[model samples]
Target: MAELAKTSEAVHRDYTGAKIGMWLFLFTEILLFGGLFLVYAVYRTKHQADFHTAAAELSVAIGAANTMILLTSSLTMALAIAAIRRSAKTASIVFQSLTILFAVIFLVNKYFEWGAKIGHGLYPNSPELLAQSHGTILFYGLYYVMTGLHALHVLIGIGLLLTMLILTVRDRITNTDFVKLENSGLYWHLVDIVWIYLFPLLYLIT
Candidate 1:
């Protein structure tokens, strides 16, 4: 039974390695956003008035709604992990599906929000945007870049969660071996946390 023992050891090593790898990847993501946040702080300080005025153009109602959506998705993701750990496969699948649904709703809201701004000629490099104060320009630039990046992450999270759902259905991610689901949930939470910061910084600058 030495072979069996060696196989068990290898599986344990792989599980530990996967967790470490996911954490390292998340750290790099944090670094990327951290640098952008620093840049935003510098610019906002240099042109506080312009930043405030520009932020007023954003719809607080919509931003708050999206914030709620992501927060709910984070909750569903956590519940998904908890469900799987308890061997409630169907419950896990439902929670995962709900998480993805919330993500989609968040993106839909963002799409309309961006469309409204674009229709009003507020987007980067638009004639109206170019005519705005330098601070206004910088504010919109950072807003678009940061929010767009976060939306991309949400899309990626949806895909990851969808995969997890499929795997759960196929019995691949059972109660005993669910590290993959856990990793996906961690990533999804990061996306939500990023939006939590972004909403206040970009949408509530008053």
Candidate 2:
């Protein structure tokens, strides 16, 4: 009985330590985005009317759908970690795959969104600058900067999920060593949270 208690305590300690480290990492991420947000705020203040006009051109429905997709992925990520810590390898793999699928779906939606916008002359330094309004161009610049950074994060997240998937399938992860899973999931959640702010800001700035 005491042996079992010792094992449980050790596992708890590992999980707790990993979670604390992840939180610290997230703090750094916050500062990274914080600088971007500061820049965005300055731009928005300088061009509120232009930002609103540009935001109006965006598809709010697609932005909302992407938000929900990411939120769902976050939930699956949580379950994946839970399954790993419980030693349910099959369940962990299934949840991890689901999380990846959702991440891909979000990416596809973003691709179409950006492609269509670019097709319509909505990108930084687009040729429309001479013929079109500057406000619209400014909006496109902000959109490109924000969404481009976000897409980079999403790509990183996909890689992280794939790694977790491999580790879960090979039985390399176990109840005693699920710290990596927790760490990756923390990063995944941070991506989702960042999008939560992005969705409303970009889709409904008006």
Candidate 3:
């Protein structure tokens, strides 16, 4: 009994350490995005008219749809973690699959969105965009950079969820050892939270 207690305590300590490390990494990500957002605010304040003009060019429907998709994915991710903690492997896999599907849907929407913009000659350094006011150019520049980075994070989150799915299927992540899924869930939630803010800022700028 004493040996089992010690083993459990050690696992608990390891899990705590891993959580601390993950949180520290997430903090760094926040700082990275924070700098971009600061630049965006400064530019937007200086060029409010151009910013609004450019923002009007964005598709609110697509942005809102992607927002809902990400929000749903976050829910599924949380459910996957909960299912794994309950030792419900099949349910966990299903939830993870749903999360991945939603992520892909978001990317597909983004692809069409960006493609439309490019088709209309709105991409960075494109003649149309360059001909626009400095504020319009800056808006699109920040839009591509910030949202592109967030999309990369979405791809990474999808990979992480897929890994969790594989591990769960292999019985490597179970009720007794599910920190991997939990951490992935945390990362996925962070991705969704970032998009939640991005949606309003980029799509609903008034």
In model 1, how large is the Cα lDDT of residue 37? 97
lDDT of 2 at 66: 96
lDDT of 1 by residue, 1-206 (tens): 99999788656757778889998999999999998899999999999999999999999999999999999999999999999999999899999999999999999999999999999999989999999899999999999999999999998888888898999999989888899999998898888888889999999988
Which lDDT values do the candidates have, in the order given?
Answer: 0.93, 0.87, 0.92
95 Cα displacement, candidate 1 (Å): 0.2
RMSD in angstroms, candidate 1? 2.0
Q: Which residue segments of model 3 deviate by more than 4 Å? A: 1-13
Candidate 1 lDDT score at position 173: 94
Model 2 lDDT tens row, 69-119: 999999999999888778888998999999999999999999999999879
Query: Candidate 1, after superposition: displacement of residue 30 in Å?
Result: 0.3
User: Which segments of candidate 1 are over 4 A away from where they belong?
Assistant: 1-14
TM-score of 2: 0.89
Q: What is residue 130's positional error in candidate 2, in angstroms?
A: 5.4
Q: Residue 160's C-alpha lDDT in candidate 1?
A: 86
Better of 1 and 2 by lDDT: 1
